[model samples]
Target: MGKLGLVKARHLVSRTGMGAEWATIQRYKNLTMNDAVAHTLSYVDYTLPRPPRTSSWTKTVGNRKSVSRQRNMMRMSKNEGAALQTWWANHMLTTKTPFLERMTLFWSNHFPSTIAGTKQPSALYHQNVMLRKNALGNYGNMLMAVSKDPAMLIYLDGYSNIKDDPNENFAREVLELFTMGGTVYYSENDIKNAARAFTGWSIDDRTGKFINRPEQHDTGVKTFMGKRGNFNGDDILKILLQHPRTAETIAEKMWKEFINTSRPNPGYTRKWAHIFRTSNYDIKTLLTAVLTSDVFWHPANMGGLIKSPVELAIGTMRTLPYRLRKNNLAHNLSLMGQSLFAQPSVKGWDGGESWISTQSLMRRSGLMTNLTRGNLRGKHDPLFMRHMPECSDEELMAWLIPVKPLHPLPTQPGRQRLVRALVLDPAYQVS
Candidate 1:
């Protein structure tokens, strides 16, 4: 309702963006909550650095077909995938629109296509662009675009689907994961019918784009969701979009994403779903409802969510002057279980408390330790200190730690020392 002061501003920025950036928080601290949310949704940088070099689809497919060249293809994919990961990691660290990147990451996980799965980094690069472009736009449009994305077609075996033999992998995931959220709402017959409807959808071998093979398509009438018609892939997507559970699935996911890890309140999710559906599945509309909702600003919900590896590592770098000793951030992220573009499965990372296993906690602590190792000494780095906001210790504490420090603050007085202690504190792992 009122101005989002330092505390509320940090909560909003840290949760939405990569981290609670000091300059952004400072600017947002002066604006009303509604204005701040609007600014976040409106501001975005679409420019991306030059993409890493990757083999063309034709070359990749040819190499895979040859026994001698298969190993070479694997090597090429491994090398190119690493480069792709670094490119995105670097962008996340330096992007002006971290929230856009965050939403892109969210959708990437939601509709995952992997380097190993596709073995086509070029296709994956284009897929990343598509996801970011529609990250805050229409969910329906994004779903349609992703369904036709070459990387998804290859990764999910949609490219191999034919009328004579319909591979139901894509259809099953669409029903169970993407649109409906689970198997309860749909039947095996529904999945089979959906797969039949999508028979002709495939990637072009030479140009690596979506193409429909009409002769290979199942043109006969198919009964899907109790509606009989001569349906195609687009028709199947339209039917799912019209389903109420599609909106509810996204709304529930938003609850876990922005709100907390606990089971979503159905009442709140239903209300948000209504807003999302009424707005024709506009992502910004759903985000507005989520951000302005009372639950988002509730005192009990503060620090309720654990930071993912990206948030913990890149967020620390963005928030403070700490930098990784090595330039292997992408590798470090993979080690910490949030590898870019390489989700563990179609379900992606389980996130939340699952991020804090004994092994991962050690790695997370090690990362924080290494990043802040330079500031452990009693004295402060003048360069780092100069970059810090000109604020008192209390304000610094509020800005750095979302909740009260779980560990006691260092009694000694240097600002850098205080920062190091707060960052390493257990409380900093959440929010």
Candidate 2:
């Protein structure tokens, strides 16, 4: 393949997946950009398992009587909550539908919570399933679903909200991080009023399901974002979704994530924001446009982002063909400064230059060493095949990096040699 096909392939792969492995990079190598985009869109989350309409906790909560049951459930070796994290990591590594997994991960960051905080495996699993279901669907619907999500209610302390003592935690994050760009768009009064609107929006103690206690709901007129009514949680959600900055804020963040730029261009950001609003906040619509846009294909975009920990770990496994032990995943990722399900705070990972640090870099290198030698406890030892087909230096370099190698390796370089060198190289740190 020519340089253009390879460059375009890397651009698409980097923007859309955990890593730009050969299997993924090869699919787009010969196809036209339009066909390639269609290929990407074809791989939705429809085939992945759909979660039940309500989690078991939603069905069971009642009071302190069930506390012992909850504790015993957590003690079980076959905890579904712990299992959910492994399932996700394995799926992302093996997936051909990389965008579906990528978007799921993105939205998880956008609406972040830890299973540690939720304290219920079913709630965590169900919330992730809901996120996947609406990953590329309607943002408005997703926001509403999240508002009623038991896991979210627990994580943000929404479960404690009541008429007399409304919790502002969830309401504040809804405006500052989730909907509007930042505190600049909303006021202290707005947050307080929004909290009132969400009062009585809480999960049942025994069922672990969301229940709006009307008796606890503040039905008195409350002004929120300049709109006055006896607004409730859903009503305030609608208001935020319709706000002028909602689309713009999400578009800009999405741009930063996929485009690898510090900030979006003025004219293009405005145009994308309009497209976002006009689509009524359809996630797939905005994403598809960005993927197919000239902005995405710019030469400056390729391999520019420092790969996040998940991207590096999963991408390596996918590209290299390895079977990592489930137990080691979280520990390894956490050591590398990206815990699988436990983000340090609601702001998410603060990814960027923060991804690189002396300790983390050393840990990453150690990981590569373990991977290269099959030294890890996983069954997929001898990670690289001992023998491989001979190839020109150019082709091998292209597989490892999007660009032609400035310093070429020997023709027929040993497979392990190439694998080790590539992973340790500075280039491998970028997507």
Model 2: residues >4 Å from true position, as ranges?
Answer: 1-4, 47-81, 323-326, 374-391, 403-412
TM-scores for all predictions? 0.98, 0.87
Writing each residue's lDDT as its tens digit, candidate 2 over 1-431 gives 23337667766876687766666667788888877876787776546544223236633342224775766544441355556666666667766677888888888888888866765667777777789889989898999999899889988989888888888999999999888978888899999999999998877765667888899999989999989999999999999988878888788887778777476675766778788889998987887778778877877777667788888888777666554565677567778997756778988877766888999989887877777664332224343442222455456556666543334443453555665566667777776
lDDT of 1 by residue, 322-411 (tens): 777455899899999999989999998889999999999999998888888767554446788777889999999899888899888888
Task: Give the whole-model CA lDDT for all candidates, comma-separated.
Answer: 0.92, 0.75
Worst 10 residues of 1 by lDDT: 373-382
The parts of candidate 1 lying over 4 Å away from their true place are 377-380
Give the lDDT of residue 168 in candidate 1.
98
